[model samples]
Target: MGCDGGTIPKRHELVKGPKKVEKVDKNAELAAKWKYCALSQEKLRRPIVACELGRLYNKDAVIEYLLDKSAERPNVEVVAHIRGMKDVKVLNLTDNPAWEGERRNAKGDCYEDMHCAMFICPVVGLEMNGKHKFCYLQTCGCVFSDRALREVKTEICHKCGDPFQDEDIVVLNGSKEELEKLQKTMEERRAKAKTGKKSKKSKGVETVSKPSEAKVSSESKPGLTNGESGGDSSSSDSVPGPSSSSKTAKPITAAGSKRSIQQMEEKSEAYKSLFTSHSSAKRTKDQLSNWVTHTPYHF
Candidate 1:
């Protein structure tokens, strides 16, 4: 079969064995996860954010995705759990001193380093180039390598010194199993928040109805007292409420019920004199101005 028809038989064409599974390149996979936005698939720029699953994304890209959720997106599964901006945290990245960024090799005299990253761990100084395991604190959003976290044990963040718990540490570019665990935690948190909001709303409604209930009780008690005998009126008035006692007390004055200002002993004599109602403020007949006839000689 090999020499038939003066044709060459390639090794691939003759092989009828089971197909070999193709493996993804580790370097390319790392670059995709660490150096690019998970949502838009663009190069990671300033104002980078991370979701609950520790996936990195550009802030603007995340905003656009949130704004137009109905639009078709290839990487929707990555950000499907993200509800809004509150679902993500902005990373506080540390700049790498050796990284030249876009103008890395302008002279072209030296070999370019493909593993170079713009940000690195402030504690261990490891480049965030996927070679090292990195995690960020949810409390402070400070990125640090896993090695540094294990070496230096503390509740305070290494970069910002913000106190955090074990639950606050989220792994960056984690495995599929880790991502699923993070997703489950995120769902539980949102559900807890929803229950809290509902409880607050119920409390608010109960408080608002209390004032109206008191008003109804106060109004009904007076009507019941009017319908009963004299002996029962006193017992009916004892229905305890906020304003029932104040409403039941009748004003004894027949007419001119206004209290006299002179009865107020707390006022100073000078302060009382400023008012026209004071005895001192009333003018005598001698101090009053007389009405005069208009004449040029009078001036």
Candidate 2:
């Protein structure tokens, strides 16, 4: 379709035979998919004109096409085009490390969920002859670009020098300083990584070391000690009664034979005399001699 006062030939007019029919089918399928997706999402709305170019194109191919076709094309405009353009909740283009020019940037670690729905912050774009040929912008899941706002006009792409006009293009942008900073930061992180300084600390972790055990009470308790070095006083206190070996002992009796209380008393006296030591006997005898007269007839 011709626009901007140019007597341009129709898309089919440029093709011949099966090529023309193939282009028509591709365009028709793209249009149908775009419309269907739009109707399904009521609140988010849809682009007035949606196309399915990405279906037949990979990201690298799409980028190369934009750069080549738009090069040498006069008045070229760069528009924002989304990949996987189904009910897109967020633009996951940032997840592509190849486009970001750095591995860290590709991770998309700093972005929020809504960040994807916002402007194409990373600005995926076509770099041509050391200068950016196009830029893409997005807001509220709506993709746009500087070229899209401009009047439609054919322009030669800066790189390939091909005749082209820009509409609904996806261009990413990043300044040299921003890229350099990102690169330096990534390097710094890499250096730190080599040292193995980073650690994964959990929520309750205050300091990483063996935790001290709870203190033992002054009063003895099972399975604990009171800090004394006497082989653990708890050991002697809890020792079970003598093992089975000590349980086989004979019983003791008050007398040699079953006797009256007087006989038992005489036996006890004899046993005491036999068991008493000579020193104790001498002491008892001296005390008895002092307390009693030599005539012991009174006894």
Candidate 3:
């Protein structure tokens, strides 16, 4: 068959192979985690703090989040568990001796050290550059590699010499399983502390209530007796029987010979009007003057 001006296509152009996947650089990933803040994703600076969950963050970023949580942020979920400044501990990291930060830049160095670390483990000579697993002590804020702790096992802290348990050790940038385990331990410790406080409060309440209950019972008995006696006396006085009526009819005289000053005043003309014996009577001049001045006036 005779073909026109069009030519046939090659087999390689017609048939396509699988797409190649882009590989992530391990050095960059490790540097990002260890050398940058987890919350702000900025280069790690001084005053670095770590949360209870072992996540590193910048102190200024944490303070800003605390001041106004509603402010817009890049990664807000990273610090959701941080309630206040108390939730994080200021880390005391050791500076690496080999790090020439400003000098290296001024020299225009072409060599990039992948193993160079910003902070080094005091226990072992391991760099915190993400190749080895690292952890921090919550009690003393000391950072150490997992291998160092496993090799030299001790109950006290390697730096501070403070005693600590397994619960005090928290892994930095840990995997999902490690974080879950740490969370479980933290919750259990808090529950134990809460239960202890509740037990103490309950005991104090019981001790206090027992004495008050006893006092109330003891006082109520005397009050009830006094009330009953008073009621009986009042009831007897209310009934106008022969004996009760005669007793009430008798005049009460506290003293036998001495007369009260009120009896002397009752015989006076000024007090006689008080009993309604005289009506529409005007007071004399002497009485009016004495009433106005409240003292006798000399003529």
For every model in order, what is the number of clashing pairs? 0, 19, 0
lDDT of 1 by residue, 94-194 (tens): 99999888897889998988899999899889999998889998888999999999999999988777999988889999988998888788889889999
- Which of the two candidates, 2 or 3, achieves a greater lDDT against the reference? 3
Clashing pairs in 3: none
lDDT of 3 by residue, 1-299 (tens): 32357867777667898888989898888888888898889989999999877788999989998999988998898898787887788887878988877566566558767679888888787888888898888888888899989999999988889888887788998888988987787678768988999999999999999999998875554334324657655865789769975543332232125564346655766665565334436666676653345456633
TM-score of each: 0.72, 0.18, 0.65
Query: Candidate 1 — what's its lDDT?
Result: 0.86
**Pairwise TM-score winner, candidates 2 and 3:** 3
lDDT of 3 at 119: 89
Q: Sort the predicted structures by TM-score, highest score first.
A: 1, 3, 2
Where does candidate 3 stray beyond 4 Å? 1-22, 193-211, 224-299
Best by TM-score: 1
Which ten contiguous residues of candidate 3 have the minimum total lDDT? 247-256
Cα lDDT for residue 20, candidate 2: 34
Top candidate (lDDT)? 1
What lDDT does candidate 3 reach at residue 16?
100
